[model samples]
Target: MEGKPEDDGGDLTRRGFLGGTGAALVVAGVPTLGGVGVEEEGVSTQLLEAVPQTAIRVTVNGTEHRVEVEDRWTLNEFLRDHIGLTGSKIGCNRGECGACTVLLDGEPVYSCSTLAVWADGREIVTVEGLERGGDVSPLQQAFMDHNAAQCGFCTPGQLMTATALLDRIPQPTTGEVREAMVGNLCRCSNYNAIVEAVLAAAATSGSGGAQ
Candidate 1:
């Protein structure tokens, strides 16, 4: 008669949620490795290998810095946690929300989805980068004037995306603005004001103070 596998006195037990493996998969990062046994219900998070770390040199706003970043650390994490730039919000912590938007090499990117190591030797512009000489960019001013921010949770991401759009289309129409800003979501449902602010800013300046 075949016998069941017994535990080796480890904190991880052999009988882990095996009854609900399918349902538990709904949780992110809870993968069942091929041999590690998260699949067969084994291996605790504490027993996982050490997170890989790497040193990268990247430019933020305008200043350059060489920093040690973990391979798994997202751009949003590097910016907010490591460098102390919290202007970028982590609304969904996924690429869908666009609340963690930042300009990476002059193009808008979802920071939460972008790995920090991938930004090596690249230019990054956060919402905090919009100011020049201690003054807000025209786009930022337009947002204020149009009351584009309600809760302000999504404003930073919105501003970054709009900056990239205006850079590509200096004089974008209302429709263009809407189409360009489709990725950035505002929970307050203030689309009209946000669009208007982008248009107004475009009329005033080609770039949104991004370098």
Candidate 2:
């Protein structure tokens, strides 16, 4: 029988030999003909090539914020972590719950679902921005007056939605308020009071009846 392939001093098989050689080449910092490094860590290091962090400028509630964030960061992260504005609650982070609602360019958007990069150079409005000169907005007053909130988890989102509705329909009918706030779920089952609150706010603000 052909002499058993000369046993290497070590248990190194042909595949193992090639693997170790590749790893050594990689660690040696050798560049391959393919213009890539031979080592795994070398490849990873090359791929990571420290890029300068991107700087994002966003206007939140009329205040400008210059923040450095990764491309993957979400608007919710920017709002809660970067700016210290945490009034917008994070319920189901997947955008199913309206708890993280905020206004972007005058439209209600789910901050959790929106990427921070996408919000760059845009105006954002959060619950904390609703007050004027430290006075609560009429919608907020209406919520309290009508006992529209309980447990208070969904109130921020409710207020934001109500603000948007009133901006569009100053005097929303009871049915219109219900339809507009459909996305916001109140675990407290305070829909009746919430509707009343919105209608009251519309009348107070002189928005006229809902279309």
Candidate 3:
């Protein structure tokens, strides 16, 4: 009979879920090859390879942050992992999909392609920054009212791009709206709702929309 595969004794065991301590042990880090294995001393060895870090000062959501970020880390990683801003989703990672979009200096850009180090001394804004106090911005409310966010993966990108457009042209025609949001792709195929939401937010710009 073939022997069952041995448990490598990884950090997360089945019982960890019940106690809740197992999940805490799974720290985010660079995992080395064969890092988890029983050593000669009968101890499981797991090590994280530390990477070079760079000091950067960035203004995110109107708040300034000075942090040491890994040189190899992308803007998306810095925002989601370091700053605890998980609103930017990592999709297509190559800039083809704009799910990882964020505003850099008031312009929409794919955070996945932008390096964290490159954001030094620059202003950045993610979807989480859309709310003022406890209320969502009118642009965000418009998206909800029009049912623009189907799966919501591409909503943030669409919102940022549309926001930039509105800032330039307070009132945009449907064609202009279409052109401005061309880069943001909605996998849910809800383009019409997204366009309508932008238009609605534009119409209500004086109310409480993103200003």
Candidate 4:
């Protein structure tokens, strides 16, 4: 050696020291934290990057949509947040309250209990879709006429359930209406009028605005 390398601090040069540490970190699969290039505890960068998203093509309110949505997103989240259909209310969020009800292929389902990916290639009918040409559908009119909506929180679910019932049975008896709408709970205790409204709508419209 001519004179040997000058020691900046010790036998380990700063550049060589830092380079070796960085290589060690890379081999250990350590992820960067902040600007210091240090790994954070309990934070797995690989898991963060692996969150899943899926592409879905669904027909909502008679319109078809092709969109990408997170896999964890619920149907209620997708409808209210992504598509802006706020009529479906999230009350219990555990399938207890039918407030988040919507028609899935002519059947009533709780949007909160349903998944967005499950609705792919399916048809959805929300309360907003009950209107035609700026006028509320006959079933909606019947609800107003019968004073079925007290707080109006459970009306959407009630409407959707009634719509499905009418789709199958154009004329359902009072017992049948009650049995069909049993899943939808109304906290306002307006059961009498709600049943009446469904029967009235069925009497007037053959299909209860299902068409």
Candidate 5:
């Protein structure tokens, strides 16, 4: 037999090196965005499209919104970015910090860890929602009165958690207040003031209702 060409020993051309001749990537439930598609050599590729979207109806601060959100987005991102409610800060970007806490159906939850899709048909309350008739809620006023917010970064989360406690107990003891707010970490270490504010609000008006 004739000697084979040296090039026949798998000369690694870019095209030949590829494992597959035609490549396609398809993800279920993902929608294509506005972009152009190009085809070459019987292979088709699309521009980067958005991730999977979920249309949800959520009531925030007594206002209902029907919006489309990417499935991977967190609740904090949805509120601050999409809904224009930036009170919930993204501190630590994890559940531990509690800076992104918000009330979901009258319960405090870490928005940073929760998915926006989980809020479908549910009520959400942020620090912005604590106002009634152009006036801050009793709990908020108490916080200011007691100077509970030193840095104010964690105030929103603290206030949200306190609001839930007062709503349930309506007059939680100092120990109860401390226990309930344990999840919220205050960098300023103003625990006493925060507890005082919550107690004061409860004594005056336990209307920490999620409005």
Candidate 6:
């Protein structure tokens, strides 16, 4: 009696029907594209959710600028785009050309490579900030007088770097000036004029003669 079969075909049919219904329900719950289950939606949403907006306040040339930027926005973009200070050229954009150089707390720094958020609460000085009472700085005047600028694309960065150097050294020798200006490059190959301008500025400042 214990081993005898019940011969319940109805029971077997019910079990198979239940199993098929469960499988259909599972298929219905899953997302499908062209009759195939796809997992792209969740991934895209996750990626979008991961991005964050950043806010920072930067003081440039004695002016405070408040901007909302993404985490990846660079200081160069903030200066050129938001603040409308485009003197810092976007050459190379990887900190190689030194064309995007600016002063941060009186120290020369590459704007292209520096993050905007990193400059929060810090003082930034650009080439546009070098003018005094509608007149250019002494270094800028010397550059013009000596004809140190050709093409003039890299002049702003050069001026900033030179300004920082002179601020520190006051009187820099030709060799020292050359060493200090190593970061800036001129496509016109106007190194002689550039050096002359720096020397002239030193003389005007009464910082002694070039060594």
Q: Which candidate is the best by lDDT?
A: 4
Cα lDDT of candidate 6 equals 0.79
lDDT ranking, best first:
4, 1, 5, 3, 6, 2
lDDT tens digits, residue span 1-211, model 2: 2122446636556644654565677566433323542346535445423323478899998889888776776899778765667788888889887888988987888888999988989999999888888778888998999999899998998888888888887777788888988888888888899899888888887542111
Q: Give the per-residue lDDT digits (tens) of candidate 5, residues 1-211.
A: 2234437756555533332222222232223544345557868675765567899999998899999988998999899867778789888997898989999998899999989998999999999999878899899999999999998999999989998898889988899999999899988899999999999999888766555
Error of 1 at 203 (Å): 1.7
- lDDT tens digits, residues 1-211, model 1? 1123435335433333331342355353334221233323464544344456789999999999899888999999899867878789999997998999999999999999989999999999999999999999999999999999999999999999999998888898899899989999999999999998988888887666566
Per-residue lDDT of candidate 6, residues 1-211 (tens digit): 1222347544555435544566687477444312432347546332123334477787888788787765777899888765668789988899887889999988899999988888888889999898877878888889999999999999999888888888888888899999998999898889899989988988797432111
Q: lDDT values of the candidates?
A: 0.85, 0.79, 0.81, 0.86, 0.84, 0.79
Off by over 4 Å in 1: 1-48
TM-score of each: 0.77, 0.73, 0.77, 0.78, 0.78, 0.74
lDDT of 4 by residue, 1-211 (tens): 1232547445765545655565577466433222233347886534224346799999999999999877888999899867778788888999997999999998999999989999999999999899999989889999999999999999998999998999999999999999999989999999999999999998898677865
- Better by lDDT, candidate 6 or 1: 1
Q: Model 3, range 34-59, lDDT digits (tens) per residue? A: 25433566666645445678899999
Ranking by TM-score: 5, 4, 3, 1, 6, 2
TM-score of 4: 0.78
- Model 2, stretches more than 4 Å misplaced? 1-53, 207-211
Show where candidate 4 strays beyond 4 Å.
1-47
- Candidate 2 worst ten-residue window by lDDT: 29-38
Clash total of candidate 1:
0
Name the candidate, 2 or 6, with the larger TM-score value. 6
**C-alpha positional error of residue 166 in candidate 2 after TM-score superposition, expressed in Å:** 0.2
